[model samples]
Target: MREIRQIPSGSSLPDTQWQPPYYDAAPPPDPSQEDTWDVVRKIWRRKWLVMGITFGFIVAGAGTAMVMTPRYSAEVRVLIGLPDPNVANIEAVLRTILPNSETTQSEAYVISSREVARKVAYRLALDKSPEFNPALQPKEGWWHAVSPSRLLKELVALIAPKRNDSAAVPTADSAPMTEEQRLEEHIEAALLNRIEVTPLNRSHVLGISAESQEPVTAARIANTFADVYIEQQLMRKQRATDRANAWLQTRIGELQQTAHESDRAVEQYRRENGLYETKSDTVIAQQMGTLNADLVAAENAKADAQVRLAQATPRLNNPGDVDSLPSVLQSPLIATLRGQQAELERQAAELSSTYTSKHPKVRDIRAQIKDNTSKIKEEIERIVRGLRHEAKMADDRYTRITARMEQLKRQMGQSNDMTVKLRELEREAQANRTMLQTLMQRSKETVDQREIQTSNAEIISYATVPRNPSFPPVTLILVMATLVGAGTGILLALLLENLDRTFRTAEEVEEYTGLPSLALVPIVRGRSKAPGHVVKKPYSTFTGSLRMLNARLSLANENSAAPGGVMMFTSALPGEGKTRISSSFAQLMATEGQRVILLDLDWKRPNLHRMFNQPPGAGLADLLNGDITPEQAVYHDPASGAHVMFAGNVGRFPGYVAWIERLRMLLYTLSRHYDLIVLDTSPALLAPEVLHLARLVDRTVLVVKWASTPRRAVSSEIRNLYSVGGRIAGVVLSQVNPRRYRKYGYDDAGYLNPRHLVHTAG
Candidate 1:
């Protein structure tokens, strides 16, 4: 058994003028109270809904995959070979300059080109083939009825202009295309869409693939595309070679004429100018060379003569200095005179030593020396004159040579101009001749190579018929559909959950109502055998919740200044189990040895009498109308051990406004006898009497049905009660499903275990 604390009596009543904390509006939800686990719990609760939607999508995807037609694909591999060596070298040079990847990509683009598709379509006649043309095939099922393509085609046909023979018609020749052009576009589109071209990694190999409903058609299209590509390559090479040959032939002729004209012009110019070619050893060249040598030699001779004149003229001024001159020394007359002078000087020296200064022998020797010296001086003068004469003759000879050389240089200058003109003409003719020979050789080579030109690509492997389809992989489709559907379903579930305005947990009630949840009453599935089931099943969860609620109400009553006061039970809407909660709370309080009274204050539709199995006779309505006394109206139930005042015959009573004073008197009278007064009032939203009763009561507890009543409705009713100065103690969440509450981890796992239940002796 659980212990119950005795609430103190003689407490003063709470102020009737008290207003609700959230009188204007409902309180905002606290963000800290809402955690990630709350969201996870919400999603977990709707897991089945999400899983069902995902499975449905997966099934639909599988069905779609099964309905789709299987398409077969065939491939052909071809090598984009290097340019031919025998043909024009320009193609080979271009290939070398381009990167390998670029060339391979170019080849792939050509393979998938619309032009190539047209060629294949023309060869295969695919426009008329039923396999390729969708319109030509027979309609199989209603699947075509919903096709967007078919619908668009039908709409186009309806709006299209009709052709009439009587209408003014344009001439057929004015159009560039023939009647076949109408079907050509359709065939090209179909072929292009069916073909796939890809290049191998870093290699000049292209893979051309074609897809179709029929394997044989796919294989044939692939192979035919390969053949067409090869033929196109060969044709392009041949055309290039032909163009090269034609251009070379035409250019060679022009070059030949140019060379001939140039040669003729050179010869004519040479003949008219009277210019002749000359070697380095020619006569004029040799003359110029000789002139240069002679000029150098004459200048050398002049310099020598000048030097000799300078030496010889200085010596002629002194007779004694004549002995130093080689010319005078070599002369025989001068040498004989020199010897006589020396011998005379020697005889005079000996005589002067033996006799007086005036002696006759000394005098005769001195006279002889003077005569020899005069003769030597005369010979030296003669030699000096001969040297001057020789120098003059050499100078005159050099001057004559210089005059002749200057005359030869003037003649050589005239000859050199003619030689330059001859050399220019010769070079022009030689160049023309060489160019003509080269052009002639290139022309011959181009002509010979034109017939043997080859393509730069070749087919390596032909396509074979494919055994399997490439599209509509059922497993992959199902997997992807499942993933997408699961994501969408989870998102939708979360959105719906957020849109729901109901309260699911105690935290929500507290956060939104701005009041503590006094109790969380687990849902009782069926009606009990008696209204006093709380006392009968004392250890049950319902009874336990009721006991807890009784304790909270007692505490509220203790807190108020007035003890033994009324605690009204009401909800935002009807059918929220407020009556049951009130009855159970009264019974639990009575079992705890308290004087409790359960009042059926719902005048419009009262149910307290039904719960107690009593007749609707002489209850609150009779007492309020002064037809009965308080003792006569109050009936005690033995099972619940509490007094019940039923709302008897409300149709016979006066209106609620007229009976307000009497109702207040009746409540005050009951408060005097009972320790706790529980009022089961009508829903606040449905009855105005609930507000009146709430104003008269000491404490008002709003009963909120869990996961069923909207928070807006509860808050609105709460705001109404508060508007009229009603004292709301707190809220109580009724009818909480225990299993769901446990799933949310709200209930302590071992707290309510069977071991905790005390078994009384029978």
Candidate 2:
């Protein structure tokens, strides 16, 4: 047979042919899923918490609605149309005068400016509102404006236009401001607030409407805007008419004076010079006419020469005509030069294909082409310069002949006619001056009429008193309140659920410690009659949970490798039901016909002696110090026939290492006779007792107190136990409160009711 080696706890198990028995319950799932579900289910089960949170939000929203202040709005419309027809179009006119949607919307924004709002504010005497009046309470008035409650309402009203139904201004003389006076400035703000000026789509008409706290004020503001704009238009038109009339008068006088002065000058000059005949300066006129004729003839000749030159020249370097240069270039030397050029061209082509124009071969080819081109250009220029000289000579000859011909003609016929011709030319000049004066007068009058026409944008319809109020959307408010309330409520519930670290259910205990929770012990409100009485068996509710714990250990028996069914109860901290749990587990096992031995392993606090009604100084400590034998230290538990061992004298006990080794050997000796051994160990965080006793036990069970242990300390305790050589049997939930558990969907009655368990104690 192969020797089986026992593996120490916390260290990796030795590789041996061993198999743990499969459990009926499913294997522990990934903790993330379990933790997440625990949190979610806790929140879902606690529906009252979420409902309470939602109600709070709903109440807040209702309060907000009641506290909000009311606002007013108004609007007025202006129509854009063609200027009075009497006016003429200006040079920059783009389209026919028609109302454009884009322009209307832009102008509406301009009308809603702060300057406009201030004007309206002043007119309406809104510097002191009923809610904002300083005389009512100056301190409170300022506070209200700055308050978040007040700010929200005003901001909403300003940005989102809505109708309002506020009472009209009082008409009595003692009223804050007269109805007319009060509404004036308010109308301005109202105009800015609820005013909507929409141009009919694809049409020239505009529709304007205003909503306000006071319906009459809305109407008045709207009508006033229309009237003011119309009046402004009229003033502009009148100014234009005045300017036109003045300009026309000035231009008429200036034109008449110019005509008279020009006529007088011409007549006077003609009479003094004795000029008459055909017209003014006939000699100079004839010379200019002859020069113009010669210029035309020269230009025609130049055109013909340019055409001949174009025909004579051929394009060099034409790809299509390689042989076009001439057969004379076929000499051996020329052929040699051409071959060299072609070779360079081939090299250049290849280089150009792969590299930039700056490459060496490309640059070399370009330089060669440039030199050949320069030589060819020089030859072409020489030929063209000769042709140009011939054309210039021909033009010079034509100019000299035309000038002489004009001089001869003037000398032959116009000698005595000079004075008469000068007089006639002066008369013609006077007539032209008079015609120019008449045209200028007419142009000035037309300009004056145009100026008058440039000044009109029509006010087509006026605003009327509004009859409806526009806000306090109840439906909208309620809907928002519902959504905010529900979401915030759920969030609050989840927060509380996550923050609570109490162990209310078996799932929670297993989730934090990575161990199965075997049983839940309910809290007892009344006393059990005797002082420090040990109810080890299921004779009372306090001891019943132990029976369930015994079943769990039995299940673990088929799984762990250790032969002895040694049990140890430990916790993260003191007062976590470790001693009580150990006592009950031993008693329950003993009642099941198994011989049980209960050891008080926690020398620092020997509590088992108190539970068994035995003096603490007569047990394990005395036996270890050679003061008594095991037979003298052991006491029989009357409740379940389980034997109990008390700590003899804590002060005289051996060190934890020596005592634990001795205890383990003792447990092995007693295991041959007893079916179960239970050790009640101290908190590992406070002392090393639990760690020492861990080696003596076959399995360990952690006791978790309800709502008492800190979650971080619990996690650390689990990690500590795993670090040592110990096997975990399961967890036990002690002192559970039924009412509190019910909120998390845990049914306390299902676990506590007596009818569920079948007993065979008979």
Candidate 3:
């Protein structure tokens, strides 16, 4: 005898502690709660696809860089110094004569100017050089090789008729440009595009560069441009100096002529005025000078005479007081007489003191004093007469000189008018002479400085042939292409994922259908001879998935009053593996020591008998037609340990409504004996019979194909089943890829081992 282990109707484990291992049937995840890892896992699963796209772009970019024409750049450095002070001085005199206003900046502009470009092109004959002329150079790039322009040109050339080579005629009406003009224009345009000028920061240096297909040509063009610029500067300086010199010479000549005329005018005025020179004295001037001296002497003599006359007149009243008169005091005779009289008076005074008023000594002294006084008076009269005569003579002389001085003033006034005209002429002549001298000095200095004038720019370095091309760097292009390709691939992957409307995980089925998921069944690669995979491969992942599904179903049954219930398996569409799942599930329940029966209620397309390798026989249809009892129709599948009943020629039964009622009766009878009865019905979406069967069953399990079934289709079918009052236990995702299943956060490998279950022998 063998003992069988059976799972209780009521599970001891809590729902939170132990859920079905195949699927997490918890409430649908919050829509707002985003899963970043889920998106990352999707991208990671498709990483190889992205890497392949990136590599393709890299290869394409590398090929493009390889076939591109090589271009080289050559640079020539120039040192621009401050404007020469000499040149600046010349510019002051002749404004706009020099082009060295701003040292480095102006030079850079000049180097990039069209005139300089034309000059450089002409010097190098760039119009004839293929390097400068795009029309002259051969087309040599991958784009050019593949271009339609090349093909068109070739085709046109082939189609056009050829003209006679030797007898070409020239048209006189055509105004074609001369070779010189053509070359000039071509050179100008070529140099303009090829040349670049940049000023160095905070320095008087400029970089003039040229780019070309050939290394040597680029170097030659740069150096030639610098040389041509210097030559142009020298030519401009020479032109300016020549012009200044010519102007100075003309001005100097004019000044010399004016100075000569001024000198002649001065001489003519001197001769006309009877003046030897401006400084020579005139006759009136000489007479006035002599008269002025005589007048001064006469005035002095008059003053002296007046003083003598005044003294003499006052002394006339006292003739004996001759000594008071200026003339009398000067005479020696008068002085002697006064002395004798004074001595006599002294002796008489001594006698009178001793004698009476009439004493003989006193009377004799008085008579001597009278005689001396009379002699002094006579001398004073003589001196007064001499003084009067001398004063009158001085007055007459003063009067004569005054009359003569007045006459000379009239004559000198006439000479003054002539002197003013003479002075004006001399001033004009002197001014002209000074101006001429200044002009001559300036002209000489300008001539001396002309040869030393030079531009404020020089070439500090010359361009050399470049060794490497500057365009189409292969490594950089490839790296950029790789990054772009990777980004594009990732975006494409996400876009496709959003457009896909299939269920990828068990959570997706539960969320869309609003039902808990019973299990996640992996795709079985090889088809089994027996449809019951849970019995044939008990240790496989498929068997484990079935076991988990049975456990979930058992728990549901335990919660209900009907422990042994009719559980029907159906899908949204045909070929969702519902039939196989139903058969496998019943076998799984039987293996756990439960009395389970598998029924094929899909009369429209019955396939249960084929799954069990049983031939066509009496099944549920035969019982409803009263041809056989339910016990006679039921067949035991020893391999799965479950009884199977087929549809058994359901076409013979014409009344489907009555058959549906009989089917319900059949299920009720089976439920009395079996712990679980699984009915494999037609897809709810395709067959109308599925809805009837759904109402008869205790529970309805919706089977969905993983990553293949459309979400809308599954959802619609579930709704239809529910509309009929069907008891929807949960959903089951079938045919899931195990490798991809693990990525959904479920441990698919953990359920593959069946070692946890011990099989007892009967």
Give the winner by TM-score: 1
Cα displacement (angstroms), candidate 2, residue 19, comes to: 18
TM per candidate: 0.72, 0.55, 0.66
Candidate 1 Cα deviation (angstroms), residue 117: 1.0
RMSD of each: 10.8, 29.7, 10.7
Highest-lDDT candidate: 1
lDDT string, candidate 1, 1-762, tens digits: 112122234433445655444454446565467789877776787788889989998987877666666778999998886556645543331222133777788878787777778889889878778866766889767866755444644675689643232112446666665546646765776677678889877677889989988888899899999998889987876676677667767877777787788778767765665443356454666766777787787778777767766777886767667577677768888888878888888888899999776898887887788878877776777777777777787778777777777776776677677667756766776776787776677667756665665667778899999998875567787898899888888888878777778877766776677666778787776655466788778787777776567666656565543335678899988888888888888877787787899888887678888888787787888888888887888888897689888987677867767798777776677667787888998899999878778777777889999889998898899789877777777788888776666545364322223234333111
Candidate 2 per-residue lDDT, tens place, 185-290, comes to 4544444556566676765555556555566766765665455445555665566556655665676676667667766776676566443334645444556566
Query: What TM-score number comes out for model 3?
Result: 0.66
> What C-alpha lDDT values do all the predictions have?
0.74, 0.61, 0.73
Model 3 residue 514 CA deviation (Å) reads 5.1
